[model samples]
Target: MALEKYSTVLKMAQEGRYCVPAFNTYNYETIAWAIEVAEEEKRPVIVQLYPGYDFYIPLKVMCDAAKELAAHASVPVCVHLDHSATYEIAFAGLAAGFPSVMIDGSSLSFDENVALTAAVSRAAHALGCEVEAELGHVGSGSNLDDFATGGKFTDPDEAVKFIELTNVDALAVSIGNAHGAYAATPNLQLDLLSKINDAVDIPLVLHGGSDIPDEQIKQAITRGIAKVNIATEYFRAMYKGYSASIAAAPDKDSLFEISQMSKDSVKEFLRGKFNLLKADV
Candidate 1:
């Protein structure tokens, strides 16, 4: 099938008590490997391209690669634009063939975030793209000690209002989850996540899935988190594969062998993650 709607897979995860693994991709190899493993596991996966890296990689190329790969995949594959900071970028993603786009207005004030999200939601919904909006700031993983730097924890009551006004399909809450690799194990505020879960009807998303203990992730899914974003670790896994391939290569210029090994690495990492979520999917 072609790219599935983000909500279709996420709502399934919410109902089945598992979180959809959203892997951020920057190139064709990454996109191909994501679908390759999802098909092998017979599970759903989200292929996300971060707009923040558009300076280095074109969004259109990423979108084309994912769409081509997902069209023939046996399992559900969602092509998404991850954390589009500006309305223009979200629209750009939509134009590039993203079935889902996330508008990151968490850095703005509540009202400001609402307005920005509402605008993007209106346009995106009309075009049949699911929108994921963030409330409260998900801070950088390196500076976990400073709440001020990462923004405040998402207010449960406010989360309800944000959903109603924006009319988004998913809400990403900041309950101590941050982006990139964590310096240490995170003590996720599952208690706060429960409150947000009770207050909202849409699927909840947890960013920074990398390095979080599996026990906490399972606990969060049991609570209400339906979508979990994993990036840093996946990139690390891909690099690990590339490094190994180079070390075992008979010649230094064996680009084909190195590339194939890198994909093997991606499939290996995904197999473990799929098994973790298999009980539900």
Candidate 2:
């Protein structure tokens, strides 16, 4: 199958009442593992590239690799640019064949965020790509206090207005979730999510999906979270796998063998995630 549009993938997730897993991949191994597991589990997956990783994995390289993988995968797969902090980076991803791009202007003033997101949306849509924008800030996991603060939760009314102004295909909302490994168990604001769902017609997204309770995630999906982003968990899993492989076989001299060990571990981890999200081809 060809690469699917990000909006279309999320729309299916919305209609099916399941949150599609969007995994951040840093290298060829990680990307291959994610796509392989998605195909095996018969689930659609979103392979995303963080702008920071672009320094190591060129935008074009990642896009071309994902396109090639998706082309041959048995399940639907889409390539996305995640947490793109600027219009230039987001545009570069879109131009390089990423069907979905996120312009994260959440740290800016509300008006400024709206303006920037709108600009990116207009440009991306003109090229037949989808735009995702973050409204309230989803902070780092190291700061647990940020999740507890009521101020960080996205206001339903503001979300509705933001979508109206920006014309984005999806909205990433902050509701007691943070990026990276959570310092403690998260208390997701499902009520707040329900209100946001009621106010906005577009698919809703939840970032910082790592380590959140499975039940909490299921509830969020039921409440209208169409996409969940995962990064820390996969990174840790792959690293642990690589480390263990070297420990078990200290004399192994082949780089390809060591890389395969890490990819296998990542694939196993992703299989569980696909099952958790109830992804079925």
Each candidate structure's TM-score, on Cα atoms with residue i matched to residue i, is: 0.94, 0.96
**Per-residue lDDT over 1-281 for candidate 2, one digit per residue giving the tens place of the 0 to 100 score:** 55788888888887876779999988888888888888787778999999888778899998899889889888889999999999998999888889889999999999999999999999999999999999888998888777867677798999999999999999999999999878888999999999999999999999999999988888888888989999999889988988988998899998789877767676888888876774222
Q: Indicate which candidate wins on TM-score.
A: 2
Q: Give per-residue CA lDDT, model 1, range 32-116, as digits (tens).
A: 8888888877778998999988888888888887888888888889999999899999999999878889999998999999999
Question: Against the true structure, whose lDDT is highest?
Answer: 2
Mark the 10 consecutive residues where model 1 has the least summed lDDT.
143-152
- Tell me how candidate 1 scores on lDDT: 0.85
- Tell me how many residue pairs clash in candidate 1: 0
The TM-score obtained by model 1 is 0.94
Model 1 spans with C-alpha error above 4 angstroms: 146-151, 278-281
lDDT value for model 2: 0.88
